[model samples]
Target: MSYLYLTILFPLIGFIILAAGRDRLSENVAAIIGVGAVGLSALTTLYAGLDFYQQGGMAYNQNLWTWFNVGGFAPQIGLHLDGLSLLMTGMVTGVGFLIHIFASWYMRGDEYGYARFFSYFNLFVASMLVLVLGDNLALLFLGWEGVGLCSYLLIGYYYVNPANGWAAIKAFTVTRVGDVFLLIALFLLYQQFGTLDTVYIVENAHVVLTDSNLAFWTALMLFLGAAGKSAQIPLQTWLADAMAGPTPVSALIHAATMVTAGVYLTSRTYTVFEMAPQVLQFISITGAVTLLVAGFAALVQTDIKRVLAYSTMSQLGYMFMAVGAEAYQAGLFHMLTHAFFKALLFLSSGAVIIACHHEQNIFKMGGLWKKIPFVFACFVVGGGALAALPFITVGYFSKDAILGAVYAHGQIANLPLYNCLYWTGVAGAFLTSIYTFRLIWLVFFGQEKTHAHPIKGVTYWGPLSILLVLSTGVGALLKAPVEKLLTSAQIPVFAIPESLEHAVHGAEHTAVGIALGGLVIGVILFAFAYNAVKTIANTGFGAGISHIWRTAFGFDALYNIVFVKPFLLLARLLGRDPVDGLWLLVPALVKGGHKFTSYRQTGLLREYASSIGLGVVVLLIVLIITQVGV
Candidate 1:
């Protein structure tokens, strides 16, 4: 009955109303419901948050009902909010509310899409809320799959476009592979711990699972699931293509909500990971590799959204590294900062796309700063943050914190992997600047290559302005508060490790030095990239490098050769479909046998009598043989 539970219910009701009333309600009314639902939920969260905080911010739990009861196992659908969950709730709902507002205006032009867009958007918010607030893993997975469904629905919202449709299926199918691993992990955890309750699992993981090998595999499976949802390596390719969705969808899902689900899951189950150091080591490596690859891909991307898409994957890689390195607080901090700035970038990109009449390629755009100077300026700030330009930007704090954790953890654990990650993080920062500035100058500074209609109104500028302010200042101001709130509960699961803290503490000067160094390197790359882009294709070296980056270092091609081609070749080898052929063969054999049997039954009654007498003699011979053998 608490408002905490109502946060999800409001959005669900909104989705149901908008969806069911799509035909009955007018566009404006439907739009209001869509935005209002999230807005109300945001309000509810604010109210609940204030009340909860005033009461010392303790954990709150509410059981709605027992989902089922079987023997001794019963995982109820419920809600739980501690400081961590509250923080996540604030991010999801607060950002979600703004996105809904922006989307209301963004989708206004699409005749029938207004109602449909909000419906899906609201449901997506509701699902993610359920994910972060769910009291048990079963309920969490429900929200998990819900977001996946909503993502597919939203990404392929432009179903008329074949490419969009393919991207949606790719996102859905690829994530399903991870989902399978997650389901298996859930089963394993249940087998080992005998409960799916979030609290119970974390509390009992160590007491229950003493087998180091079993723990390692379970954690690995969980990481695979996290990677799938979060778009990490091997499961990361779909994210870049997810740009096919509407811009609001990009900001909402890619930037703020669905992608972060994996991180939330990992944070909530830190104890499970705490027991498996080997798996954590693997997470660090996967994250480092994914970021480097995505950074490389971002450097050469032509489409604006794709660049942001790759940037997202790269940033996610950093979070994974943080959590893998057992810097849970650092990981969660980065997730928060990322949600603010990345969402800003995407929404700002939305405005630009609108001005350009749906043109997405930055190379095709030029000198838009003079036309929409506000958007141009916003991108600069957003770009600076994305590039992690020095101390002023929040990205520096969150990113540096993670980097420090990696170094400190590496040194403490005596694993050289963390050293490698620290360097990778630094390099990614530099490349991020190069590519981000490349996007900025290409679209806003160069000679006008394509004329764009100017964007003029508060609807476009309002959200961008608010986000710009938050992206710039949020991290610096919230640093101490975030650390305190997250570690306040002081449970071992959410606690910042002493080794990681000492490393971060010792490496303070190193972090500042790295930030400054990365900034300077980024600036140099920016100048070089900005100038080289003009004639890169004409020069041999430039052309080759450009081709490599343009191809996303051949990940797309790798998938084709490794997965797609083999699948097609298999289909060719069994053109009829092997299982389908088996079904056809059954009918064919029956017909052939019937034909053979029919021939034995001649039309003449004497033929029937001869066949019956022959059958009887054959049966007698078989019986005699059987008796002799026995």
Candidate 2:
């Protein structure tokens, strides 16, 4: 019963209590139990993290039991905490608790509120804990699927709506496609390394994968899994549609816990990534492309949460780029900061929506800054952090670290085509700022487009306030330690360019200038466009562009046509028809055999008895003859 186990177990205990007592307990009590469990888990994680830090990055493992032993292979159910898991556990519990608390308020009025909502929320926390704490690949998969199930449950928490249920199914099915590759990659790792333990696999990767190509393919498959979970490239569309869930669930799944699991997996398996540099390059390119695509999509979105959803996808792309560049700590740092601000932004947006009587379209919201001052302030801080507004914000520090990593890779490591990645990342930063501020201006600073309703209670403001503070400070607190931890492995160092240094400071200000330039242009353009298109007739001029943006550059359509349709058709042709034919043949043969057997039956009972007796006599004579011959 070490603190590590307690940190994970507390949430499970809460989940059980809330789930079992759902019918009996009131919504308020259920909320308390759910939030209280996660709050306690957060405290336990903090204590465990402090102990780990005091011990200076040493690894701690607590074995609960032998999970399985067969054919000379044994896997244990255990918890492993190091710098990586410590960071993740803190994020999961801390941010997860806030989301649960927020959900308590957001889901207050719905029927079956306590039973339906908290059950999924608590289960989500428990699944995320298992994901970060598992010591071996098999156990990791269990957590992985657990989180997927919880995600499906939470996304479709309002199952009365068929659309929400469909959205949940879409998410589950898409991610599961990636999960298959993940399972294959794990089996391949075990086949090669003879073990699925993270440490053992990393240490013996060289022995098992003597060929670089094998390692490259294995790592690539694993990255495919990461891509799906992190919502990169072909698998990214589900994240945008995931806005159908409750706002807090969206924040938890998209911003903080489940989405970042892919990047964390890559970081945890850094040595494997190191061995497969080609795979790393592929990851970088995929991330860059996803960033640009999602950024454009975000730019055109009117729904506040959909904008944030696309932003999450874009930010995740940046994270994947960092991981691919071997900037593990930089990526994790961005994740930490992004979690704070993104959650803040969503919760604040939720407040605004609730204040507006559940309206989510930004076009229908304006001049809300006066009505909900606290929420407005929270949005500004969170939005500022997201736009990477100068040195005072968390986004500034974390995003700078990521770009610095890429700059180091290009200038010092002499990695081929690294400069291209560096420039793409810079462009993404600018686009990120533009789209972020566009949402801000449309919702908060614009002309009054809709009448405002008076907001009630501190429930809306409480979570927003807590997150705003964290959004501003988490980066500065963790920056130095993360840097040290990432670089302590004696890996080859990448140097930052002098120009990039100037960019880091204010001396040579091209990057900042570009970012600000994009923001200003986007603000002016969006304001004019939104104002001009106040009526339906004015929107016709850009109808084509609007369609293209709304369709997400037809990526989903292309995937449906190229992959989904063909596979389904082939399944119907080869899988269904042939299998059904075989089944038909078996039944037909059985019918024919029964038809033939019917001829042996006699109408009279005496005839059947005489036949049976004759057959027995014949059998006995044949047996005697066979026995004598033998």
Candidate 3:
């Protein structure tokens, strides 16, 4: 437990080393340092996790120092090791290390900024660790902003391309919208409670926030902040575009790090949400809507990474729905399974992209299943898990847990809204199945369209194979311990009423049928009915809808018209404003005066002497006039 800080320190040190040694370090050395740092962090998390649970999963606060003392609002720089943090730390480091190992293979020949890439990658892991492990809101926000900064850097890693740079900026700018809401939440929490300690805030929220409306507003602000980071609804446009980064960056951001931070935040502060039932309902509705939107968007995406990217948004919506339902354990459980399968899917897609000579459009490559059989198998398991194949995949268990809990919550509360949310989850699962398998079929089947290079080496297959197993039923075993841990912490959860148990079981079974049904339909449609799919996509009403879905229902364009254009127009307007011109006059006059004064200072010796004589005469005239009081 004492060595918990090492988890963050190792990665931080790795970032420093890689950053300092940028051009000096060989590829092997940089890869070793980068992968080894996260490996050490994962080991530390394992050791600390064992010790933590052995001591009965009690909340462990390791206070390192007092950050500041300000009029009784003193928050310590501390680490919090509770069930939630431990789970999150394990996921971030464990999945992150694997991604780093695979990245070494994926990014082998990049002589430009290889070490720099790993530096940003290492810092991303460390920042996420800080976010999950921090004991106070301020320290957590530091980690929060750190994650955001690294995302921007990595997303724009291929900076020679202007489009990638714009993608990075878009991601940074969009998420900051939520960050502001989060910052405001922090100030509100501090004002209301006099401290920003996470443990204290969660434990005492019910006591201090006696006004229901106050609790609702505070939680709403926090959710808004979370919604931004998690890429829900309006803030979601940045994530698909964020696929411009390296595939490993896509895996890291989508699977294990930045997107999950929002879910973690909402889950960590579950008590606050618990106090505001209305806010909780709002969260569920937002999540439900987001999942549907993202799922439909995924359906029309041609870029393989963008397909997975939208799937990530859709999956994150599930987590948000779980948290909003007061099913914290279920949400975290889904997050865990999602980390494995989504990472598998993204990294496998990376292999596909690599083998196809970086071709990203699924239609450009087919029948490569025979060419890269291992990668094909990877897609099968990963995509199957993503689609939640019944009884065989971890996603099935975790996702069902969420839907079951949501169903039970709705029935128990007798809320028609929650029941509708349960149906929304089912509909999302159906969409997930269709697009997931649609990707698999279009890329791996049909006439071979491109030559694929053979994929080999330990780094390539090792992580994928391991993640493959975890994406299966074997990974479902973790759910029990996770449930026990969170329940032990007394985090609020929705319980199914005994009377509604049968109905909940029915709901689960219905979801299973829907998932299977979607899979079968997707295979048939893409495999046998592809011409019809194509005809629909290229023609009338179907084409219009496809275009809308392709554009993520034009949220990007809508935001452009509503927000981006207006802001840019205003900026251009301000560019020539009279007020700005007024301020500009000072610099303009100063520059003019400098030009006038320097015009006579040419380097010719005769000109210099003439100027000096004229100056002397002028000085004598000025002195005579002053003396005569002119």
Winning candidate number (lDDT): 3
A best-first ranking of the candidates according to their TM-score comes to 3, 1, 2
The reply for model 1, stretches above 4 Å from the true place, is 489-541, 571-630
Tell me how far the alpha carbon of residue 19 in candidate 3 is from the true structure, in angstroms, after superposition. Answer: 0.5
Over 1-630, each residue of candidate 1 has an lDDT whose tens digit, in order, gives 276788999999999998887767777898789989998999999898788778886778999899999897888889988878888889999888888888877887685467888999999999999999999999999999999999999999999989999999999999999999999999999898788989888878888778999999899899999999999988887898899999999999877799999888888898899889888888888988988899888888889999999999999988989888888888888888888889889998999999888889988998999998888888888887887766667787778778887888778778887888888887777677667877887889768888888776666677777788878856568777677668754433334467467656656556556546655665565555646555766699988987887777777789999999999999899897788877898889999999999787768999889888999999999999999999
After superposition of all CA atoms, the RMSD between model 2 and the true structure is: 6.4
Residue 253 local lDDT, model 2: 93
Clash counts for all predictions: 0, 0, 0
- Cα-based TM-score, every candidate: 0.90, 0.88, 0.92
Can you write out model 3's per-residue Cα lDDT over 1-630, one digit (the tens) per residue?
Answer: 887899999999999999999999999999999999999999999999889888988888888899888887777879999888988999999999999999999999885588999999999999999999999999999999999999999999999999999999999999999999999999989989988988889989889988898888999999999999999987888899899999999999999999999999999998888889999999999999999999999999989999999999998999999988888888889999999999999999999999999999998999988999989998998898888888899999999889999898887777888899999999999999999999999899989998998989899999998999999999999978888777766766567778888999999999989989999899889988989888887888898999999998899889999998999989988887879678998999999999998886778999888888999999999999999996
lDDT for each of the candidates?
0.85, 0.81, 0.92
213: Cα error in model 3, Å? 2.0
lDDT per residue (tens digit) for residues 1-630 in model 2: 276888777778888887788778888888788889899999999888778767876778999999989997888989988767777888899888888778888888777466557877888888888988999988888888988998898888878999999889989999998899899889889888888998777666666777798898789889998888899997887887788888888999987788999998888887787888889888988998898888778877889999889888888888888888887777888998999999999988888888888889997888888877888888889988887877767887777667667666665567757668777877877887888877877788777777777766566667777889877855578777755554543222345567567544442145556777777877766766655544542466577666677677988788889988999989878965786687798889999999988977769899889999999999999999999999
In model 1, the worst 10-residue window by lDDT is 488-497
**Among these predicted structures, which one has the highest TM-score?**
3
Off by over 4 Å in 2: 206-208, 447-449, 484-508, 528-541, 566-578, 581-630
